[model samples]
Target: MSSTAERQGGSPGGHPRGLYFLAGTELWERFSFYGMQALLTLYMVKQLLLPEFAENVWGLAALRGMAEGMFGTLGNVGFASVIAGLYSGLVYFTPLLGGLIADQLLGAKRTVTIGVLLMSAGHLAMTFDQLFVVALVLLILGSGLLKGNISSQVGTLYPQDDASMRDRGFAIFSTGINIGAAAGPLVTGAVAAIWGWHAGFAVAAGLMLVALATYLAGQKHLPDTPPRRHADFQHPPLSKADGKVVLALIAVILLTMPAEITYPMVWTIGPIWVDSYVNLGFVPATWFGSMDSIGAIASAPLLVMFWASQARKRREPDSLGKMAIGTGLVGVAALGLAAGSFIFPAKDSVPLIWAIACYFLMGVGWMYYWPTTLSLVSGVAPRAVVATMVSGAFISPFIAHLAAGVIGINFKRMSPSAFWAMDGAIGLAGAVLLFALRPMLNRALGTDKRKDAPENAF
Candidate 1:
């Protein structure tokens, strides 16, 4: 009975009720995740990593001395970047192991459950100075389980044969992510500004609990995870064409690292830059994180329409071409920041609107590439290797964060323009490389064939 119910497709409304359930689950999960993230680096620098914190509290002089000795000559921004970079990077890497665990041992539902629980506990633990490391470990492990599985389950909610609807479903699902992204910083940042950083973290923890509750309430609606059998573990062999496509994708992912790095770098440290340079009287730095989400949400419907119109006219860019443009846009976003820095040219902060503008451009860039890449993989990879390609997609962030962390170390050494200019160059290089490879990608993946309906705009 359970299996039969799980096999049931979309509802009378032509979409699955499960999609809404999963979307709600993801919405709250992201709410908690980004909320905590918005505060993390600031919290670390203000409360944990700096000498001032230890100076104010008793029996902490040794800790302050240790940090000062270890991070010599690097300013607070650079030191904070190291910690943020490692934490952000490791979060992506854990998903690899989490995916394996979900496939082999616990199943998606159970793994996601465990992940949510750990994440909730991690957020709560952040209130304590002594348990900081433990908190990070729990959050990383939990995110690993929840992130991939929840997304995979969204695919399971649809019938196998309905390709068009499935793509639309993912598009709808992604909007939920953007909604959370926009709201998290606003709520958490405001809370921190009023009460304190610990309060902000506590709010994130509460949101995670809400997410857990939401998921559990919709448990009956969610598809069941099939038990893994040893004999069923083997992957089907990829054809020569698929093999070439896979290699092409690998190259693409490597080149997109600079673009990927922009996300974590901006969210973690962009606020620091804002705080140092921008003299906004009352605004919280974390509010800057919302710009990307706000831009994405505002432009989603518009972009969908634009793409659909282009597809109808046979003028829509291919996945690789879109990614090239997206990559270039991220560089353009960095350039925006550089422009603002030059305009200010003093120790004082520039108008907050300038930073907001940069974030909006980044949001536009993200909208083009991030969601599109998933569909590209689904469309291009052979059915037998789809799962492999999806898993491979996760590797981009893992590599991205590691390199971003290394990049973060240079924060203090370079001026704002120089730092951003460097990122801009990298993004442009990736774009040029992908543009050169577009012909090959077009042949391997074939042109977009879903012109039958505009609803397939994902």
Candidate 2:
């Protein structure tokens, strides 16, 4: 369907039918991904890395030796954190390759299909103890293929001029992400607790199959991929202006990395923290990983409504402003953790309310920045390289996860308050830098002219 037709003939709720389908695909994909992620660190620390199980996994010894050689001796938790960081970081990093493949070779649809199949295989591989590393590799490769292309397609669902609708559409799509993220850990964690970890992985594999089916069912509704081009592909030259815009986008992405670095702690070491220090009664520690998603899911609609109201009053912050605000909020959330640690120094003494508050703030921060970043890229990126740019945007998270991993190694060595305070400092510094660089960024991104214009004018 043409973008014009899709927009004009949108569903009763005024969105293209394909949006929901894509969102549904993302929902299931995230369900599987997050389900596995919620289990990964805990599984490693408690089961997989133990001598009885670790010896069974092929090549694990070599992998451990290599990691230790680079980062010094790592006990089980520290090693798990590093592996989780590498896995998480690589997951985002691969999108750059996936984007290129989609743009130059296979086109988005075919690439996405391949991604889904690989991810499904990865999830199934998780069912076998010996296939742990193999499973991670498959999942990373598959995510690299799927993430950027799927998101790029969402931008194609709307008329190029309809930036407002497109932004709202991304918000809606992100809602699907949070929904799956919220539910995945809850369901899978419970399953693992009751029936063991492999059973949880089996469930993820099943959900991934459902994601593939959803994408297939919606294929006709999705935008058709343009024919792949290979001749002179190595150098798709751009105008001077487009080149500047690309550089500006990269800067913005880099500035966002500090906030990104703060994010993985909630998943990588978060479960372990909760398991060791929080009094949860019967609740699984992995359930804490879902708190941010739940907060995001609840707040998304309210945020959209709030932004809409501001738009009507001609007082809405621009995308850059929103991002700065988001980054600040993430920093504040981290500070909240630091405060909790200081006040409740005894193990498991931290109030549950404090952790919940931290996750809630982080969720709000994510909503403010992430969707805005996606919408900005979709709207302003040169058409020739939009998909590639979208994928490149994910590089922030890639950098963040790698850094987070390195920083996480200190989790065992430092006091909780000190560690969290350091993270808070990083996020706050990024927010300050982004705010200071706003004018330069706006001019470079060519958004200076639209600063005082209507939100839709962009």
lDDT of each: 0.78, 0.87
Best by lDDT: 2
Superposed Cα deviation of residue 384, candidate 2 (Å): 3.7
What is the per-residue lDDT of model 1 for residues 1-458, given as tens digits with 9 covering 90 to 100? 25423434555446677777788889999988888888887887788766655344333344335545765655666666766776787787788788888888989889998999999999998887667767888899899989888899898887788888888888778878889989999999999999998899999999999989988887888878865877987767787877887887777667667688865567766877787887667888887767788988988888889888898876677677788888888889888877888778676567888888888888888888877787778767777778768777867878787677668767678888777777777777777877887766656565434444233322
For model 1, the stretches where C-alpha displacement exceeds 4 angstroms are 1-12, 52-73, 233-235, 444-458
> How much is the lDDT of residue 250 in candidate 1?
70
Q: Assess candidate 2 and give its lDDT.
A: 0.87
Question: What 10-residue stretch in candidate 2 is worst by lDDT?
Answer: 449-458
Best candidate according to TM-score: 2
Give RMSD to native, each candidate: 3.9, 3.1
What TM-score, to 2 decimals, does candidate 1 have?
0.90
Q: Which consecutive 10 residues in model 1 have the weakest lDDT in total? A: 449-458
